[model samples]
Target: MIQVLEVKTEKDIKEFIDFPFKIYKGDKNWVPPLKNDEKKMFSPHTNPELEFCDTQFWLAKDNGKTVGRIITMINHKYNEKVNKAYARFFKFESINVEGGEQLLLFAENWAREKRSTHIHGPLGFSNLDNQGLLIEGFEYLPSIASTYNKVFYKDIFDKLEYQKENDWIEFILYPEDCIDERILKLNETIKKRYNLIVNSFKKRKELQPFIPQVLEVLNQAFAELPYVIPFDEKTGSYYIEKYFSLLNPNLIKIITNKDGEAVAFIVGLPSLSRAMQKANGKLSPWGIYNIFRAINHPKVVDLALTAVLPQLQRQGVAAVLITELQKELIRYGVKEVETTGIFETNTQAVQTWKNFKHIQHKRRRCYVKEL
Candidate 1:
């Protein structure tokens, strides 16, 4: 028998977070998230996103042993904007198809009680959080920002009649192939024509002040993307604290126009998947050293996020950012680059990868079912 328990106490939440550790114990590709970091998302004080969303966590127990976990979330902004009571389920994990089914049913009932008409995800509060379940490239170690999961996991969603809502594709690139002389020249021309400037900093302090504007540009740039809830000041600050602070200054590229308004930006990090794997999700002295080592000497870097303002799309502004990125890659002696997922429907973003020698190695999807 499957017993679904609501996660109410701190101990129960800890058990919810630790369940994956049990399932992926012998799996080599699995990367455990830092415990403290995982806790912050469940805390309203730490994650400002909770202010605009309602969420519930549940764990499945079989014979009194925890077997699965899931989070049911309803973003008020998304529901209001779409004019539909759509709920999302993410942070999903299970040991078997039955366990997975029980977890999904728990989420569906919760959403139904809230008057939601549809349920979708393997999505989180926003795009910044991990979304999608890994449907391919099981052999490849996932980057810090991406997800990794057992291939059989999809069977549960299929059995539950969840139709594919969207798919995001990931690519692997040879940084050296990203540099094309013609594009470099084109970038120079675009910069001159548009009075655009590419800013590079050797220190994090220099990049701090521009964080707000960078996020504002991000909202403008990705406003049209599916399920993208624009970030307000509080949410923006929370993101900078969580993800941006860990970025190496040299790997960031920010492009601005004559008035110093950001038009494009790209953020990459030396891949720390391996380091985190070795640390088993703890970031103490040795783990911290491994992370620093990865930053200073990474063979594979992860292109985590990139965006260009809608008005500036297809204006060669992206080429300007890439040209600068190529220089940084070469300087770092990086061999390969793994890109974070880009929505398959986002043709503009997907097209940019075609310019380089790359392959779509991994694909993930969001599944949905009408209530």
Candidate 2:
């Protein structure tokens, strides 16, 4: 018989965090997440999101061996905004099909007890967290910002009768497929017309001052997006500290208006996928060195995010941001870039990448079912 138990003790939490290692042991495409980072997300003192969200983690054991793990989370802010009680699952992993079913049923029952009317995810505490299940692109390795799982995981979700809530698509770009000349000329024209300036920094310290403004712009730009809940001040600060600190200054480009307020921005990280694989998700001396090597001499870059103010959308600001960032990426000898995830319905964002020779290599889906 399969036994499901809630994560209670520190030992249980550690097992929950480490379950993926066993599940993806020989999978080259699976990038291991840092254990400490995973732990921090579950700790209320570290992750402010816990204050507003209710969460439970579970481990499935058979014959005293952990065969699966899952987390059920309720983002109250998201529910309040969408006016639907939703309980989301994240970090779902299972070795056996039957075990996966039991995990979902356990979460569904828990959500029902909490008065949640529906269950969804493969999602997490916030948008910045990795969300969605990879339904395609099993060959390509996932970037650190994305998730990868066994192909069979989709089959399990299918059996549970979870309908698609939404899908996010990913694209891959090569250096040979740079922006077209006409777009470059258009970007110049837009910059001159709108008094837009693309800002570059020489050092991480130099970029520090603009971090808050860039985040503020991101929150505003992404506010109208479907299923988005704007980040609170504390949550915003938490993410800024967590993510931005690791970015290479040269990979970030911020667009400002004549008044010097940031109107648009794009951020990329030297692809650390291989480095993470090498580090095995540890950040000790060798792991830290691997990351620094990837930063200074990266073979691939991962486009993390791009955002523009609603009023400035389609005013050529998007094209300008990409064009300017493209030059820097080339200078750094970067060959290819993987766009982490773009919502399927984000036509404007999707259209911007169409100008380049690219492949829609990966697709991830959010699954939903009535509780």
lDDT of each residue in 1-371, candidate 2, tens digit only:
89999889999988988889887887888898878888887788899999988988899999889999998888899999888888889889999899999999999998999899999999988888888999999999999898898888899989989999899999998755455788788888999998988999768898877878887888889987766788777898888777765788888899999999999999888898888888886899999899889887867989998999988998878877777778887787777889988998888887776666788999999999997
| Predicted structure 2, TM vs. truth | 0.97
TM-score of each: 0.97, 0.97
Q: Report residue 87 deviation for candidate 1 (angstroms).
A: 0.8
Q: What global local distance difference test value does model 2 have?
A: 0.87
Candidate 2 stretches greater than 4 Å from native: 177-181
Give lDDT tens digits, candidate 1, residues 186-264: 8789999888999898888989878888888899888888889898899888878877656788999899889987888
After superposition, the stretches of candidate 1 with alpha carbons farther than 4 Å from their true spots are: none
List of clashing residue pairs for candidate 1: none
In model 1, where is the ten-residue run with the lowest total lDDT? 174-183
Error of 1 at 265 (Å): 0.8
